[model samples]
Target: MMEHSVIFPDHRKVCALGQGTWKMGKSALREADEIDALRAGIELGMSVVDTAEMYGNEEMVGAAIRGLRDRVFLVTKVLPGNASRTGTKAACERSLNRLKTDYVDLFLLHWGGPHPIEDTVASMIELQQEGKIKAWGVSNMDVPEMERFYAVPGGVSCAANQILYNLAHRGVEYDLLPWCRERHLPVMAYSPADEGRLSRNPVLMEIAQKHEATPVQIALAWILRCPGMIAIPKAGSVTHVQENYRSLSIRLTAEDVDLLDGAFPPPVRKVHLDSW
Candidate 1:
């Protein structure tokens, strides 16, 4: 198996793949499936769980990771509108309550909003000091927006930048990914399969056939191959979760990557950050 880990600036070696609970709470009928799939991911060594207060599924994630709290690296996001010092603090508390955890391993700003980044980062810092979050970061921030945050006091400490990244959306590679690399900040790819849309791509299908895996697995393995990057691909069932977990073993060669490049070429120009 091709085992991999994303070593963050803090020296934490987290699993490259994680569980994303974005739409896992869509219906109460599937809560059992959601919970089992999440726990199954952890059991399969995909121990990073990324959820968001805005996702409205923290409780389900909480239930999923119930007895396995100590084994999971928990992450959750606060909405951008709640980026204020007070709002950020309150939102994190609410998330913690929902997650049934005392502290979140990572707390993120879902995206840039009307609130000031400095104030928001400051609030995040305070939260860190308060032991509410192990680390803090932003989501969907382009290089320019990140530069603005870097100007703030203690902004250089931002741990990770979660963004829309996948085979289809390689825009971040133009600048943001490299910029984050220069700063030693890990970039987390949310919706690494383009929210499952990449599964139908013939190019990926060809590559998947070479590896005897699904197109989604090939796309995810590609994301995991990047330096200082991690991907959280949501799985609605245990089978899907296992498939994602197995993607770590699907090694892509230079030829494979080149082939993918032809289909989903790297971005040469700056593309605005695509947020949910």
Candidate 2:
């Protein structure tokens, strides 16, 4: 497994395996099984976990990481509609309570709609001051929106930006990725496998065959090659988690990277209309 400290500007070292808790619920993985999966992830050196109040899995995550809280970098998000400073503060406290923790390592603005972005960001800053959250950022934000946040007085550093980026969905490459790179902000890629689409791509298959690795590894390896980039892939089972961890060892050549890039071009038009 890949074991390395991913340092943010604030000098925090986060684990790269970042367990995604979107599927951690009785309906999804069963409460007991979810806890087992989380424990296994930590044993395998995964220290960062991504979750949200909207996911209904906070309690499960809290229960799983109860004793290991300090060793994990817990991140969660707030819904955009709850932009009122009071509402945001209440949400943070509720999340802390649900997670059975004193504070989250990072709190993200889930999106930039339903309320003025400024209102929500300002609230996030206030939460930081009160020590409810250590750092704050935005998810699904575009270039202009990110720039606006960066310009705010006392605006926290854009520690990380979460978005859908993979070999198949390289739309962010046209602008967002480069912008973050220039600003020294890490791009946390969700769906780095293209929702499993890249696992079946013929070009990736050929590359995987060359290295005796799975296509998923090749895709993740490509993402790791970029500076200021990390991927959070959800693994519901031990086998899937192991597969994702092995991605760190599959080194790709410069030629391989070029081939994969050519094989999977960025989308020419917007595919998903619904807001993430």
Candidate 3:
């Protein structure tokens, strides 16, 4: 099995595997199951919960971690549209009210937007000072954007960078991942399994058979193998969540890594970061 935790530049630690709530709380019929799935994942030590105001599910997350908040390392995001200094503060208040928590462990700018990065960075610093958030970061930032982010005041305090990374999308591995690693910033990978597409790959299937695991688990294990990388995969049911948790126990041999790398070649040149 691989290591289970990643440390930020400032030395904060979080689970390598986390729960993603991209389209959560969108269906009343599946709400109970989704909440149960998140709780089950938390019980299994995947306590880094990732959601956002954009996902429209902070209230559901609030309900799932209701009595168990202290056990969670909660993470959420502010929409890019509301990333101005004042807008950021207003967004945090709304997120806090929806999450039913006094403070979010980490808050992120959903993505680069019209607002100046300096303004958002200033706002994030202020929020930390007020104890409204423990730390702040960004999502969907490529290397150029990240460089620009670092150029601004207070940008060095960015704790992590969340991105779309998986076996299928290794473009970030070329430059973005290394750039963050150089700065000691952890990367929180959203859609790490490519929304289950990797589950059908014949190569992953062959490898999973050798390990007596599912192809999706192999995909997740590949992501977990990297240092300073975190994967947040959405599981809408308890069984799915348990399957994802089991990936942490998988140990892919060197040959297995080679086979996966051969099947899904890493990028040799920088490419645009994929966001969904």
Candidate 4:
């Protein structure tokens, strides 16, 4: 099996193919299936589990990792509306309660909020000091926003930047990706499959046939091609998560790369960072 992992600035290593719970926890009917899928991923070497309070699924994640917490690299986020110095801490506590864990391996600011970055940074640092979170990061930030974030005191301590990145969403490749790479900050690619849009592409299907893999796997493998990057695709069923885990073994050749590049052309000028 091919193992892929991302090392945070703080040197904490997690699986490059993490489990995403963005749309998980909404339906009670799929609760057992969701939990089983998460556990199955862990069993297959995907130990990084990303969740958020806004997803309203922390409790579900909590249940999934029960008695298996130490085996997982857990991450959750603080909502931007609750990103104040005091509100950040309060929000984290609520997340912890929902997660049933004392501390998250990583905590993130969901996005740029009304609160000052300085205040959020201070609160994040305080949370680290209090052992509520091991590290902090941001999500949905573009290059300019990242620059502003780094400008704040204590902001440089950010461990990673989670963004909307995938084969179809290559806008970040224009500048944001290089910017993060220059600083050696890991970029977590969410919605890596583009919500299954890439699964039916004729070009991708050709590449998948060559590799004997699914188009979705080829798409994900394309994102994993870069160093200092992680791809989080939500899989709500055992079979789906198994297929995602299998994507790790795919090694796209240079020809495959050229083919994909020609199909989903990389960004030319500086395009605005895309988000959901």
Total clashes for model 4: 0
lDDT of 4: 0.91
Residue-level error in angstroms, candidate 2, position 17: 3.2
**In candidate 2, residue 16 scores what lDDT?**
58
In Å, residue 164's CA in model 3 sits off its true spot by 0.3
Q: What clash pairs does model 2 have?
A: none
Q: Write the per-residue lDDT of candidate 3 for residues 219-239, one digit (tens) a residue.
A: 999999888889999999999
Q: Which candidate is the best by lDDT?
A: 3
Q: Number of backbone collisions per candidate, in order?
A: 0, 0, 0, 0
Give each model a TM-score. 0.97, 0.91, 0.98, 0.98
Q: Write the per-residue lDDT of candidate 2 for residues 186-248, one digit (tens) a residue.
A: 767877787787888899999999999999888888886676776878777777778878887
Which stretches of candidate 1 lie above 4 Å from their native place?
A: 1-3
Clashing pairs in 3: none
Better of 2 and 4 by TM-score: 4
Q: Give the TM-score of candidate 1.
A: 0.97
RMSD of each: 1.2, 2.5, 1.1, 0.9
Greater-TM-score candidate between 2 and 3: 3
Model 3 misplaced regions, further than 4 Å:
none
The candidates, ranked best first by TM-score, are: 4, 3, 1, 2
Candidate 4 lDDT, 49-88, residue by residue in tens: 9999899899999999998899888989989999998999
Candidate 3, lDDT over the whole model = 0.92
Clashing residue pairs in candidate 1 are none
Between candidates 2 and 3, the lDDT winner: 3
